[model samples]
Target: MKKIFLVAIAVFTLIACDKKEVDADANIHITGDVKGLSQGKLYLQKIQDSALVILDSIIVNGDSKFESHIKLDSPEMLYLFLDRGQTNSIDNSLPFFAEPGNIKIETTLKHFFADAKISGSKNHDLWKKFDSINSKFRDQNLALMEKRLKNELKPNATTTDSIEKAYKSLLTRKYRYTAHFAATNGNKEIAPYLALSEIADINTTYLDTIQKSLTPEVAKSKYGKMLNEHIKERKTLEVQK
Candidate 1:
């Protein structure tokens, strides 16, 4: 009888361990170290109904390392906001693509977003690649703006016209590139996200093409649904106009 009781206790313990492991697997486990941060609050946030909502948060008392977890239904864009008590700066928030499973973020207190090193999320990796190229377009636009300002100081109609034309051409190229990127990456959630965020004001025909190109799985994602709704709203306003 004593032997049988011991065997039953061992089996129960094994079952309990398995259950805990399964639960952990279902959650998004985030761990990171904020170098130079002695005390602060870190928040895991997502956009819901056009508002930033906090999913989880942790307060670091003296240590720079922190961990947070939250259940995710599907991969989407999320932000890690750091609030260093009594220190105000515009570089505190870091945005990352979040999916279920483990993600690690390492950054310093001084340049939170610029110094962030994110790992373990494939969606974030994809966004990083897209953003790298998109940034080039932005840089070109800024240079063109500088040229326009310099020309405006002298007020030459010919030079102004040439710069204006270049600006229009650059804008068209940027829009087309964004559309192509979204359509080519239709299988990823980032596809619809980029469309809605970057080029929603472009031709509705382009938006229509992107919406149709989304895979069945991606079409049901959070950003995918928002893209669909946004397209519909744009069409409705067009008709009213």
Candidate 2:
């Protein structure tokens, strides 16, 4: 009987140990491999209430590789800081949108942010898409300016008016495109993100529609909350006048 009781107690202990040893769910697992960085500290930061808050940090020693895990509540932008002990503050920080997944970051110590290769986040992918569309509008403006400059043609009142109208048309098209993207992509977290990042300067009613059109999950995200608050504030201010 004594031996049987001891065996039962051992089994119970084993089960308890197994439960306690389960691996935690990491929202972000960042594995970084940096050349020439044998020993240094890297910090993961997020902006909160207009302040930069350090979420996590890791020290790389012996090998030039380090790993870090961050608990993310929702998809938002994050910054990686490399503290190289340099007096010159250039080429250090890399900002990337972080989703709940494994993200790989590989860069060298010489030129950190410029050479950094980050992958595996869909939020960042949407950000690139937004940038690509915005770039076309900028390129059109640059081309117009270049044509005027290279021809040595002065923009007289009539010429200036035509140029202004051309630019205005481009702006209007970009704004419409932005609104369409946000409305159609309302299920994705990027929808709310663009509402604030890209089209906030447009009409308040449009912004309100974007805010209201966000899907329940995306609406609960950080950027989504900001969109709701921004629309509310703007409407309140307009009412005050």
Candidate 3:
């Protein structure tokens, strides 16, 4: 009876140990090359309709090699940014599934993102879903901007000033508010995407309201033209790219 009891206890201990151990999730390494650029930063952000979460970031080493590890619970949108680098490949969204172990990511770019290869997951469906959603959102944003530019409406000086001020606020706004949510929930990947998504609306609504409040002369002055021209240039850049 004693020997049988000891065997039972030993088997229970082994089971408990197995349950407690967690294998390292797949490895994730991101590689990219930028023409005529060096010493920039790369960030990975998680996306949501309501907010963005910053999952991780790293300095682009001289060799342009960067690696990170992510353990995903479910399918999520990954936002990549070259971050102030002159490289045309500044932003992209990809679907990522993190299982147990390392995955490899390699990308090559001449002007924009040219090639990307990912290995170590069989779930290609998740990637397709993410890509579709990302494209839809981008189209929606461009459409809104195009509509505003085409309207050709004019606003007074004071109102336009207020609007521009508000637009600037979008960039200056702190990330802490959105990021706090991720930290509180124990999934910190959504902060950056959440923060960036607000920039467009902040500019649009503020300009729409303030322009209606402007005086005619203020609208026609060099200052007003400068502001309008700046906005036009931004639009041009977006479309050209």
Give the TM-score of each candidate. 0.84, 0.73, 0.36
Cα-based lDDT at residue 5, candidate 1: 100
lDDT leaderboard ranking: 1, 2, 3
**Tens digits of per-residue lDDT for model 1 on 1-241?**
9999999999999978744232454578889999998987999899988899998777887999988767878888999999866776889889999887899999999888889999998889989988998999899999989998998888899988898898899889999988998898888888899998799899999999999999999999988999999999999999999
- Report the C-alpha displacement of residue 226, candidate 2, in angstroms: 1.4
In order, what lDDT does every prediction score?
0.88, 0.82, 0.47
Could you give candidate 3's per-residue lDDT for residues 96-191 as a string of tens digits?
533334555566433334455666543333334434554655565565455445443764566556545654453343223323332232222222
Model 3, residue 217: distance off in Å is 64
Clashes of each: 0, 0, 20
What lDDT is reached at residue 154 by model 2? 58
C-alpha lDDT of candidate 3 relative to the true structure: 0.47
Model 3, stretches more than 4 Å misplaced?
Answer: 1-37, 86-100, 125-241
Q: What is the total number of backbone clashes in candidate 1?
A: 0
Q: In terms of lDDT, which candidate is strongest?
A: 1
